[model samples]
Target: MPSSVPKTLTDWWCDASTEYAFLGFSYEVTACQSRDQLHREFADIRQNFNSRYVRLYGFCDRKGFYDDIVDAAWANTLGVHALIWFGFDGDDLWKGRRDVLLGALHSNPRAKFVTRVLQFGSEPLYDNVLPHDQLTQQVIKAKANLSDLHIPVTVSELAYGFQERGGAQDLLDAIDSINIHMLPFFAQDASTSAQAWPLVQRDLQWFIDHGNGKKMYFDENGWPSVTSSSVQPNSPNAVADVPNEQGYFNLLDQHCTDLKNVVAGGVGWFAHIYSDNQEPGYGIYDSKGRLKITLAPRTSC
Candidate 1:
């Protein structure tokens, strides 16, 4: 299905399994109160998957900061690998909380540090700030902030997290130099939806043909929750669950297999574990985390 010819990297992807399982807490900020049991909970989540890779880094404060966020590392294996890119404000957040971000980055700048890096897949809340050269400059400067550092970036290639609407060419041109984890999260309606697979295929072909298809990833798709559709829309945010599970994963698996044939690296799962019945319901699992629900796409609900 994917037009990609077999290359060594693609070959590796075909054979390897980058399927990661996520383990998230209630998805909230934790002060880790004395005998608070957050650590105990974290341990349980980590051990639940046995595998070292983490697809879900909890549901709250997707960004890596704050005292509780720092404690998240304890949940991660010292050498375990994972990704964390819930719309990070690299330019602004890095400025004030460089230490926090750097600490997060240091864990796995290289593949071993963190299998991949993530960019902002957060909603296009700030469409105005992305179109200008300023966005590129900020990203560049942010990368510069870690010149000697081994931290590599994982980009939500489809995500346009700026305050303005714009084209991918500029963003690609901007990130071309940075040797981060070159992966796209399938967010851009263009990137994720099966209907847009044709365009994505074309884009991938262009990149591979032009030799500019740097490190790539299809990190998202299949979130059942509508944009901002949480468990309890009125309450604080919680990792949401997808409504039509099978239907959602059908597209997800198809995208994974198709891209696996094209990209140099194996595909990374969008998430592993997330909260449910809280705020947004984009999770692969149900609220109890016990049921593996699958919903097949239908012509009509």
Candidate 2:
């Protein structure tokens, strides 16, 4: 077994592998970043980060970029979970982009080997980028094309969206899982790190019960370390005094532990990110590809 894998869900290893099958990293590549750098980073993740999958954020626009990612994942034996953008900028190029992305996924020789799940969109309702009906149709259309591959297809939403009965319900029935962004600290009724688990668990149960038997998967979950100005401005959803380094460790450790016991159930769980960025703060590694305080002593097999 790879040394980067964790031994148990609660092990919190500095140098241990886990029995868990699908711990993933949310990845975002900036324009300035090079393909060579990505190749090295992908290798590093496979060797040191204890992750078997990656959650890519958009319906990739550049063929070269998409191909580079495929090469990287293939070289490191990492699964790729591609997130189809849901008219984020507008509907102008959405259809065309979807066609291009689907074509690539269908034809890429390496895709069938490394691609695990193809999500329709990420947090569409939270951003109000696309109507629920439209997103549902997009998922259905993709499901039709990719059904032969037999990968799970779903749309991501915030936990709160599942609490009510309406468009969110329509979506829950149309897709495979109750995939959501469950950031308790970012919830409207936020709590501190030590007291956050119950609140998070309550939301998870709400999704499991109300989501009409669909499996639950956290599309994004992590506590931010910097509440002040650095990288991306702290999200508006974040509570005041979000968490320092130690607080981040405490919250993530507890949440992930509970996730293994109360949720997942052999399904996947993706951390919000692999590394800190100039825009987003929820990264285990710093911009220099170094482990941050929260991920000190990370080791390879």
Candidate 3:
């Protein structure tokens, strides 16, 4: 037997490389913010995955903002970094909510806040109702706005329930990093995992072509999803769930390959079934917050 073993790409990436595999747990601060709670949670999460960092999202929501909320949530926590954000500001909320969020993050040196689309122009839910030119202009302007705050915004959930894999070069060039929230299924798609493979390959090419020299993250893209029944087939409400087993594994395998080739800053999972009812039992961890073994760390080969 060889004296030393060659670590699998995943192992080396997570354990040895400075590029950490952050299997982050995301939640609104108000939901999981108490310092005692955050500390307890961090230790458990660390045990489950040996994760180097965590994303602490949603500090402010309809309930509104509070001073040092992020600080309060993360109080006394060590080894994990938080990505907090002020929640959605609908047409009715405070006028300068985004500005307040920015200032809060600035004061809390330990917190990193990522920005989302203040509004999406062509999203299907809006029937492409949001003005096209104005929204696109805002996206471009948003980049400069972030620079002014000295806050580098990592795009998250940008493709919200859509799948147009091309044009990533321009997209990546426009911001600090590109994040595509790609789900594994769409009721309209016939090939399931196979249908998404092309997009994955194209994204990999984007990373290979540019990411090695720049910051790029597929902030959300994965095979795990709600049950097949969740799909609302053959309607304007169509959706295809990422099924478990063979189909999902097929995509999971490809995703693993992409993780190997691409210079990913991190990958965030979509559910915390225990805390939020996004999709029950779809969590990387069980209802009590214990990690699934497949995702859990291994001590033996």
Candidate 4:
């Protein structure tokens, strides 16, 4: 018989929902054609897709990038699920960046208003950026610093991290919700879009069973429509082999159907991405900001 992994979930997670369905879009100006082009894409997200929220990976960009994000969100009436990364270059440089981010949030009314939830770190354990104990402490201190805002605070980690041993138990105990990255498409034995719901359901159930009854937020979720033949299967860059664009749409339709229940059951989920990228090809929209065939169903949701 196989032995059970130790439960890393703390007792503080309670039954509740944060009531926010965010769209995951990493903001990198260089990735886009131009700054104006990026702003137009955000506007398209709001007006076309009915996206109420977005999650940025981090705030360590060039001068005006923060403003660009806030302005775009505000103009479109979208909430911001802001993520912060501490892997800054040079000694003690992260503190300065952190201060700048907080300052913008404190001083800029639009920035503060659009900021719905503040995530302190992303995949820290998986990335090996910090020890679990220290990570927990950072989450505790960050929660204290942002207590006055009354928004939810969380540390985002991969689903497997929370399900297995040496996960973010202390951090989970400290925060307001469980933010998990549930991406079965990235699994080595990846499922076809048609076979995704069962896998996703099991994954979500694993988190919920161990979630200490806290709000389970699917922080990132999506399917890729493109695959490079040369890219090794089950590797970091693997994309499923759907027959055509219509097959991708069917997969998304079924995936969203599965997710509707999760959201209805007091959980939250963010679609994988807003725009397709050079690599991964997971975007619901092409690089030119045109809706991919898979995105038609999302517009009504």
- The number of the candidate with the highest TM-score is 2
Candidate 4 segments exceeding 4 Å error: 1-35, 86-94, 228-265, 297-301
Better of 2 and 4 by lDDT: 2
Candidate 1 or 4, higher TM-score?
A: 4
Q: List lDDT for all candidates, in order.
A: 0.37, 0.62, 0.39, 0.60
In model 4, the number of clashes is 1
Q: Residues 234-294, candidate 2, lDDT per residue (tens digit)?
A: 2354443334434644554544444545433523456667777733567777677666654
- Model 4 lowest lDDT segment of ten: 1-10
lDDT of 1 by residue, 134-235 (tens): 555645665565444433433343333321343444555655321121122233332233344454455456545433545544343333444442222222
Model 2 Cα RMSD, 1 decimal: 6.8
Error of 3 at 192 (Å): 6.9
- Tens digit per residue, CA lDDT, model 3, 1-301: 1133232212222222234233344443545344555556656555544544444344444322333334333332323223323234334232254455546554544333222212221121122322334333444665465554344443344342223434334434544544444443433342455566664555445454654445433333344444445433333332234344224434444455345444543332322221323333344544565543244422121
Model 3 weakest 10-residue run by lDDT = 116-125
Residue 247, candidate 2: C-alpha displacement in angstroms = 3.8
User: How far out, in Å, is residue 160 in model 3?
Assistant: 7.3
Tell me each candidate's TM-score.
Answer: 0.54, 0.79, 0.57, 0.77
The whole-model C-alpha lDDT of candidate 1 against the native structure comes to 0.37
Sort by lDDT, best first. Answer: 2, 4, 3, 1
What TM value does model 3 have?
Answer: 0.57
Q: State residue 245's C-alpha deviation in candidate 4, in Å.
A: 8.3
Compare candidates 2 and 3 on lDDT and give the better one: 2
